[model samples]
Target: MPVAVVLPGALNPLAGCVPPFDRCGARARHATGPWASSQGTQILENGDAVDLTWVESAGAPVIVKEESLRNLWGGYVNSDYENACEVDGYAGLVTFGEPTATVTGLVINEIPAPTAFMEEYRSIVQWISSSSDARFVEMVREGIASVSMWDEGPIVRVNGPLAIFDAALPGTEAGADELLLVEIESDTPAPARESIGWIP
Candidate 1:
C-alpha cells in the first residue's frame, strides 16, 4: 500500500555505507589456535579487517593485534615490519621481526616421484633417492628472505615455535642479537589442519 508508513529514522544513503560483513569492530578475539601460538589468527581492525596469522613461536606478545592499525590510522608510512609481514597465507614477505612464515601451498613430508617407470628414467631415479620422511614447507621469499636447510647449525626455531631443520633457514647476519636461535621446544602438539580461523 502507498499509505504513509512511519520509519525509525530518515534513511540516509550514507548510513551503513560499510557493509555489515565487511565492517570490523575495534574489538578483536583470538580467531583460532591456542593463546599466542604460532598457528593462530590475530585479527586487526581498520575500515577493513586483516586476518594476521601468528607466524612465529608461541608466547610472543600479540603485538600485531594492537600495532597494525596504527600505521593506517596514524597517516604514517607502513614500516618494514608491516611490509615484510606475510598476509593471507601468501609467502615472499617473511621478515626478521615476525619471522613467522606462512605459505598458502601444500606442505608435505616428501614427494614420491613415479617409481613404476623405467629404471633409467629420471623421474624414477629422483623418486627412489628422495627421502620419504623428509619434511618441508615451501613458500615464496620476497626481496632477500630465503629458506635453506643445508647450512646446518641448530634446529631453526622460527619466531621461536616452529622448529624446522637448520637446512630450512637462512642465516641471520651478525650483530642481529635479537635474532637468537633458541633451543627451546614447544610441548604443544601440532594441529591437524594447517590453520585455525577461530580462537576461544
Candidate 2:
C-alpha cells in the first residue's frame, strides 16, 4: 500500500518490508551487511507488495541498520537523487522535486542512524558546493520535503527534519539585505531512523 503523504506523524510505511528472518539467518553470507541484500524479498517505495527477487548490483553496507539494497528499484531511485540535508537526527533525500511520489527504492530510513551514516552528506552538501545563501535555503527545504535520510543513490547519505529547517530559512529578506546563510546541522547523535507506495 502507498504510504499516505500526510505528515505530522505517520506510521512507518516500511515496517514489514524486510522479514525478521532476513535480519539474522543463513542469508547473512550473501549480503554485504545486515539489510542491503541482493536477494530475498523487498518492498519498493511505490507501494508494491513485498516479494522475492534476485539480482546483482553494487550496494553500500548501511552500518547503522546493517542492510543492503541491490534491487532494480535501488538503482532507479538512486538515479533521481541529487542531494540531501540533515538537522539533529532528521534528514531527507532531495531529488530536485522529481516525481518520486511512489517509486521503488531503498527503505526511507526507520530511525535516525544511531551508528555511522553517509560520511559526506550534510544539510548544505550539493553536487557543486555553493556559497550562496539562497542555495543553502533551497537545500534545506529539499531535505524537509522528502523527510528523512537514506543512501540517496549508493554513495551519499541524506539528512533533515524539514519543517524545522524550512521554517528557519528566511523567506522575506531575499531581494533586500546582504543575505548570508552561515551554517547547517551536522554530525549529531544518530537517533536511529525511521518510510512506502504505487501504480502503473
Candidate 3:
C-alpha cells in the first residue's frame, strides 16, 4: 500500500486531518467516470459512500456544471476553461518557493487549468511586488503552506501571460502530459518572453 503524507495549508492548520490514501483503499487513488453521477460519494466495499471532495485523487476529471461555472471569476469562465476537465493534480500542493539561485526556466507539473497557473503567478507577484525584497525573502523563509494530501511541485517562477508558455497554442492537446504550465519573472516590469526559457 502506498503511503500519503498530507501537509497543512497556508491558512488551515488542521488541513492534514484526512485519512491517508492507503487507508482509503485503491479506489480512492484511481477513481473513474464523472463526479456528477456519483451522488458526491465514493462507496467502499462495505457499501459506504464517502464524500467525493475528500477522496483526494491526484489525477481525476471534474466536470463543473454550467451553474457553477457562472460564479467563477468575473462571473465568467476563462476561455481556456471551456474544455478543462482534469482534476487538480496539485490540489494539496507543496510549493518549492522561488529558487534561491536564479534559473532560466520553471516547470509546474500536473495542474488542472490554465487559469490556475496564471492565478498562482499573479499571487507570487502580488506578494513580492507589494513588499521589499527582504520581505519576499522572509516570506520564503516562512515557507509556503499547503494541504497535506496533495502533490508537491515547482512554485510560480514568474508572472507571464499564458501565451509565453504557449498555453493558448491552437491544436494543443488539453490535459496532455507534455503540456506543462510554466511562468517567467524578471527584474523588469514587463520582461521579454526570451528572458526565461521553458524547457518543457
Candidate 4:
C-alpha cells in the first residue's frame, strides 16, 4: 500500500486514523456522476455503508463530483487541509512554531488571497478572480504550506476549482508563520481503482 503520508515520530497527530486510500488506490478520489450519488458513503462487502470524506488516494487528485469523494481537500477532512500537511504529503503546511525550510512564499496576511502567492509563478489570480463556487475559493486556504512547487506542480494540486495543479488553477491560515508556505512533493498518478492498485 504505498501510503504516502510520512510524518516523523510522534509529530503526526492522526497516527492511528485510517488513511482513505488502501494499497489499491483511493476509495473516493473523484466527486461526480455515480460518485456524486453515493454521497460520500462506501458500501462494505458485508452490506454496510461507511461515510467517506475527501481522504487520501494513491495518485491523481480528483475534482469531478462523481469521482470526488466528498470535500475538496483530499485525504481525511480534518479541521483545515493544512492540519495534516506532511501526514498527507503536502508541503508548505501551516506550522505552529517558527518557519521550517519547507516554508516559503508570502506570509498569509500579506497576500490578498492564497492564490496571490502563485501569481508570479503560475498566474492563478486571473482564474480565481472569476470563480463562482465559494467552496472552491475557500479550498486554497491551506497549503501544498511549502506552496513551493518542487519543479513539479501547483500548491493545492486538487481536482476542484482552487486546484492550481488541476489545470483549473485558482487558489490558508494559522500562526504568523503558520500562514507561511511549506514544502510539497509530487507523486505519480495512480490509475483508477481497477488499474494499478486495486483488482477490478
Candidate 5:
C-alpha cells in the first residue's frame, strides 16, 4: 500500500483529507479494474479496473487544471544613501542598508484565470513588502522576475500572459502561496489562461 499526503484547502479540508489506508484502498480500487483476489495485491481484487501501477502504466494524462497553478517570488532589497564630502576626496559617500531576501512567484501551472487571483495575491505581496519584523521587502522587490503558466507536453510551453510586478509592496512574500491558492478556488472551473498583470 502506497502512502500519499494530500493538503486540502481551508474551506474543505475534509474532502482533501484521506487516510493512508483509505488512500491505498482507493488506489487499489482504481487499479486492477475489478478482477483480482486480495485488496492489497498489485493486481487488485477487482479485475474490472486497473491497478495504481496499471494507471501509471497506461500513462493517463494528469491534466493540471486551471486551479492548480502555483505562484512564487524570489529576491532581495537594499537601501542606498549618498552624502557630500568636505576636503579633497571623492565627490560623495554612499551608504547601503542590510540586504533583505524574499520569495515571489505565481504558480500558474493549473490556474484557469490568474488575473482574478491578483487581489489576494497582492495583499500578501504588499504585506511582505512592508513587513518591518521580517525585513523581507528588499527581496520581494527584486526577487520576482515574472509569473507564467506552463502546460505539460512534449515541450512544456507557457500557457498564458506573463504577470510582472511594477512596484514592491509590504508584507507580500510571507503569505504569497496561501493567498494564490485561495484565489484559485474562488470560482468554478474554467479554461486556463495567462494573466497580464494584477491591478489590485
Candidate 6:
C-alpha cells in the first residue's frame, strides 16, 4: 500500500499532493529520521519531507473530532503567524478538522506578536470567504470554530455552525469583532484497523 501524509493547510501547498518520503538518493539528500517498523511508522524531519505511512493512514478517510479540528487549525494559524509576525502574542485560526485515525486533539499555540497581526488575520479570513474554493468554507462550517489564545482573552464563546463573523473580540469586552471562525467536520467515522495497512 502506498502512503501519503496530509499536512495542515499551511504546509500542504509546499508539500505537494504526493508524499516526499523517498529523498535519500536525490541531489539534495533529504533525511527523514528513523523508521519504527514495530509501530509501522516512519518519522520525517520537519522540513518538506513526507511520510508514506502517515499518508496511507489518512487515506483511510475518517471523521475528526471537534477538539482535534481546533488544534489543527490553531497550529496552522500559529505557524503562519510566527513566520509573518515573529512574536508569541499574535495568532490566527485558519481552519480545523475532527478526530480520526490520521489526527486527533486540538493543536493550539501562542505565536510571536506582529505589528500587523490583526490585519493579517483579517486578510486570511477575507481571502477564505472570497476564494473560489467552496470546499474551504464548507470544511470550516462542519467543525467547531476555534479562537487563538490572543483572540480568546475577550471571548466567552463562539457561535454557530458557520461562526465566521462571531469570533470573540480582542479588546473591549462590550462587543464582538468581525473576526470569523471556520469549522471543519466530516461524517466519516474512525477507520477500522483492517482498513489500514502498514508499510515495512
Which numbered prediction scores highest in lDDT against the true structure?
3
Prediction-by-prediction clash tally: 13, 28, 8, 31, 62, 22
**Higher-TM-score candidate among 5 and 6?**
6
How do the residues 18-105 of candidate 4 rate in per-residue lDDT, one tens digit apiece? 3334567433222222223322454544564443222111122211111121223322333222343223322233322223422221
What is the alpha-carbon lDDT for the whole of candidate 2? 0.23
The candidate, 2 or 4, that scores higher on TM-score is 4
Q: What is the C-alpha lDDT of each candidate?
A: 0.18, 0.23, 0.24, 0.23, 0.20, 0.20
Where does candidate 4 stray beyond 4 Å? 1-31, 54-167, 172-200
**Model 3 spans with C-alpha error above 4 angstroms:** 1-79, 83-86, 89-134, 142-200
Q: Model 5, residue 91: displacement in angstroms?
A: 41
The sequence of per-residue lDDT tens digits that candidate 3 reaches over residues 57-137 is 233211211111112211011333222322132222111112462222221222211111112223211111212223332
- lDDT over C-alpha atoms for residue 32 of model 1: 28
How well is each residue in 111-144 modelled by candidate 1, as lDDT tens digits? 1111111111100011112122110000111101
For 5-100, candidate 2 gives per-residue lDDT tens digits of: 111223344332122123243221112223223123444444433322211111211111111211112212343222221211123333222265
Q: Looking at candidate 1, what is the lDDT of residue 119?
A: 12
Candidate 5 minimal-lDDT segment of 10 residues = 81-90
The TM-scores of all predictions, comma-separated, are: 0.17, 0.18, 0.19, 0.20, 0.15, 0.17
Model 6: weakest 10-residue lDDT segment is 111-120
lDDT of 5 by residue, 129-192 (tens): 1222122222332233332431221211223332222111111332332121222323323323
Q: What TM-score does structure 3 among the candidates reach?
A: 0.19
User: Hey, what RMSD does candidate 3 come out at?
Assistant: 18.5
Task: Pick the winner on lDDT between candidates 1 and 6.
Answer: 6
lDDT, model 4, position 90: 24
